[model samples]
Target chain A: MAPYETDDSTRAEDADDLRAGPRRSARYVVPVAVVGVAAATIGLVPALADSGNPDLPKITAQQLIEKIAKSDVQQMSGTVKITTDLGLPNLGGLQNSMASAAPRGGSGSSADPSSKLMELASGTHTVRVATDGQDRQKLSLVESAAEYSLIHDGKDVWGYDSASDQVFHSTAAQDGGKRHDPAPATPKDFADQALKAAGDTTSVTVGGTAQVAGRDAYKLVVKPKQSGSTVGAVTIAVDAKTGMPLKFTLTPASGGAAVVDAGFTKISYARPAASTFRFTPPKGAKVTEEKDGAHGDHRHPKGAGPSSHGLLPGMPGEKGAKGGRKVIGKGWNSIAVLDTGSKGGTPSASGAKGLGGMLGSLGDPVSGKFGKGTVFSTRLINALMMNDGKIYVGAVTKDALVKAADTGH
Target chain B: MSRADPETEGTARTARPAADTGPVTEPAGAGRAPSPLRTLGLLRSELSTTFRRWRTLALLAVLAAVPVLVGIAVRIQTGDGQQSGRGGGGGPAFLTQVTHNGLFLVFTALAATLPFFLPLAVGVVAGDAVAGEANAGTLRYLLVAPAGRTRLLVVKYATTTAFCLVATLVVALSALAVGALLFPLGDLMTISGTRITFADGLGRALLIALAVAVSLTGLAALGLFVSTLTNSGVAAMATTVGLLITVQITDQLPQLHAIQPYLFPHYWLSFADLMRDPVYWDDLVKNLQLQALYAAVFGSAAWARFTTKDVTA
Candidate 1:
């Protein structure tokens, strides 16, 4: 009805109303049909892949180590941007990027441990730390957690919470793995749990090349041998030649993209103290006093059944029986994460709580209290021999534990 | 120039029924049919005109784009304990926490739009509601006929409401599209750590959209009120736009935080709280009530103003 529009229409010779017939239907129909067909193909990609082998790779401990030692250095250590998605007491989860982001202290435990606890009178407790030194892990100790130091000159592994100035000590022996502490439980945990677990030569295949940290990096895919959630396939950037891991990436087995990157800064390769490698408690530390007894003296609790191998009711029976002496039984209270094959994760105040929760939920370490501690009990199997094997671990005390290790029964 | 040759018409030959006329029963099929609904019909026509313009179409297209972008953003966010360049740390737990904080985004978007852009778009439609008729010289003819001020006010409100609906839909759809693409679609973990599935997500999105629609009611009523205040389309638009910004600035000041929640647009975003595992219906109900109260008060004022105002322009 605008004057100019009407005038333009009049000047067009008003050609036989091209939109008057069947052509009108065809005009809109053809474009819509073409678009619909194109869209269908784009949605079919995931369905097209063969269900079984998605060309996944396998990883091993040694392989994990070599991948990290790529850039051999004498000294390195720095702040690592760490985020543990499966939320712990103070951890983040799938929505991490969108919400409260907490920075932690990992003197070398995980940021937030699965479980951590301690009794002050005994100064004996367990803890986990972040792979990086960032997270607060204190709940596990009794008295001065003040001596918390993974690189102990002669002390129990512990960390200092500067905010509260509380010194927390770990109960578990500082094994070379991350525990329920933000600080490194041991150098090995930081180097191996992720770097070592993922750092591999044979296990990692070069996917392609890309730039990472402003340096040339190789896109290497590191797949967990048994993929499917609990243990998932991950990818990392490796310095092609030196094999130094530059960045770590994770892609959940269940579909969804957006691989998060955790970059490492300031690292050290200096040899840990001679005392750190040795497991010896400090003087006056009231650790468990082991009684002297022959390995053969220890035995399984009376009336214990084969199904008692510390497995969730539905889980498979111990692979230990086959190896006879194999220590292959599941740790009901010990969620032996295959990801790191280390004890329930880094120990912190709640490290024990975290692993215990996961284990309690996933396995069968039905809750019970032992002493003042919430002791999550499960069958402990004897060391399973790779060659000639026998099974005998659940017994009374340490002598039997050693004898069982040597005698295999 | 025949009968239409009126570049310089004789002193008194016009379309009016001389001096005193009841209603000119113009013949149909003769010309433009007297714009059918008369005053109300003209108001309706005035609103649709904005949608026909390129800027409105462009806004709609932009609205459609939000969903995809949101999806992408959710997908690429960092999940590990730490975040990298240009991104925040993200994870399953964090995602749930953010959902609990849903109302924040709603309030932010509402406040953001009221400032310059959204109100401008609204004014483009509302300002034109009356001044446009005058500009087109349709007002003189309309007043000479049956269109009284009452019918005109109602028609203008209806058209403005329609534009508001379309704009709100644009914002909601865009947010949803982006959220779906960026985040996992199956389940949403809540701040409390409980998991709610997509069924809940979809349901929540709907409530949120409705809440957004509710928020717009205030703006719509404001637009209509402004439209009735002046005959100039641009002036009415500037006035409303200025008021929106002033309110937004005041709402953000820490000193004003205590009373901010009482503002009409304050509770509009509470709809997002619906997506939480234990959906906080309390805030949502409060939001709706507040918005309703705002709409009622503003609508009444607009109604009164338009009904009493002289339309000599």
Candidate 2:
């Protein structure tokens, strides 16, 4: 309501100033905008660079296998150490243990379940068990180091090494004193393959990963279709990131059955240098050189598994619980645990009748040894807690294992 | 010769001091204590001026980027399994190749040993330091100031050191950044076959940085000495670079193995030896002592020559 008045000159000047304001700001505004755009562009350089490489290098299991197949490798060998978390087939009910538990009967059973049997990890061990189903007279292979391997054959036993010039036949003959071989693979192969088997990726699952030589591992489970074999079902743990297998375990179908497992420690992916693979026979070591191809013959018997699958042969028995402490054997002290009863509720062959039933019974022709106490004849690989209460007996066979139940000779 | 400042270092900078005519006169009613050791202050100003020199700043920036380039090279070359160490006999540990830094290739194990890349670069940058000023004719102008010749040398050396530290820091930080971005900042598998976690690796890297500084001090001093020896900036640079290269080459030959221990860069990377599980200290101490001795000798020689020599140039 005041004077709606303005001097024409002043109005014109005010209008002119308004027009000039934007023009003046445009100079700085455009430049600032350009600078901001430039800064943003510079910021995007890393992003652009990353986008150019959309696929991160992803190495997978298939790729690993392919690489292995493609590698120009000649041969590989080294010192391999194996640690087992699982026990034997007859000892299926045994727990995954750092050490074995005590026996049960005066026979070979222990009074203390927490006490241990002979630990496989006692010392340096290298064993070779091989098989080839051929000549019954072929020398059975029992050497510790595996060169003539039969693991890939996927069978139970092998022939002898008697005629093979590759290794000495004396030790081979002493092992196989019998004229026949068992099946495709033998004990020598198992001992050797066990270490390598531990590194095979059998199955994969998401689980607690372990550090095998500082590499992350993924769990693998491999189960066999049947039993009576060194490997009924192997559960393996592999490195998820590296696709390298780390640990392997063989579990029997029955709980408390034998559990054989192998764990690798301080593994390295490096191949040995050229000189490492070459080996020259040392002085006095008995070996017959075959002029040709990996010379040897191995055979196996018709059986569920290898002949040496259960235990060593030629053993003595029937010593009471408190007796038989002397380690009179070729390979130092040995202890063997056997399964008398079956988890399937059936009796195994050569079944030693339950001790409780024979406590009072007189000597029966078929059932009882009639208070029979025989001097342990073979090696000391078996023992049990008896009615007499003691530790290991020097029983080397299943019968000897039963004989170890009584110590009151 | 000018009077020595007992308060500061006896041998300061790479130039000669003025003739010792008299002592500092307690100025008229000078009550304020000579401004709390202007060493750090003048050092700061010298740095600002050095950076203002486009040539110096560009050279420094390029040198800083060398590590990143090295990282790129490494990213391109590694394989599935280590090939260098493993073969028919020797195992995988033998196959480990050197790290990706190209400067390392030229310098031998210096990168692995002392992490000396930064220091070497620093010496080159700093060697022509005073000579550059002399060529610019700014040396006399600065000497005539009330601060004095010895003070000017101190300032120059201070500036050179600052540049050395900055340049080394730049390269190290850039290397760390590039390593972080380009490679996994996880555990390191040490050449000695030990596994080091990221934290441990980081600690080792920092120690390497310190070792690099120690190693570079000798070179920086040597450069300053060379700079003092001549008024030509190029000659000073060539002399320092030539010395660095010669010592590096000799360190590699097996026949020179015995004599290698005497070379400065020979122990340049002795810092890496610190990565051992228990950390071997004897070699590290020796390396530090030798480097310090080099710095002292070069520094003293430069001072002695500068004080007596005529500046006809």
- How many pairs of residues in model 2 come into backbone collision? 90
The positional error of residue B87 in candidate 2, measured at the CA in angstroms, is 8.0
Worst 10 residues of 2 chain A by lDDT: A105-114
DockQ for candidate 1, C-alpha atoms: 0.03
TM-score for each prediction?
0.37, 0.38
Q: What lDDT score belongs to each candidate, Candidate 1 first?
A: 0.39, 0.40
Interface RMSD of each: 21.7, 28.4
Tens digit of lDDT per residue, candidate 2, span A1-409?
0121332222222233344555433333433554465457547975664342122244454443333234332222222233333321232222222112111211111111111112232222322221122211111111211112111112112211111112222122333333322221222223223323222222223333445434555444333222222233445455445454445544544444334444443444443333221122212212332222212221211111111222221111211111213323221112323233322111111122222233223222221232432222111122332322222333234343344333223
Model 1 segments more than 4 A misplaced: A1-409, B1-47, B66-120, B131-147, B175-184, B190-192
Q: For all candidates, what are the clash counts?
A: 117, 90
TM-score of chain B of 2: 0.75
lDDT of 1 by residue, B109-168 (tens): 333343344545665666666666655666545543443343455566677767777776
Which docking category, incorrect, acceptable, medium or high, applies to candidate 1?
incorrect
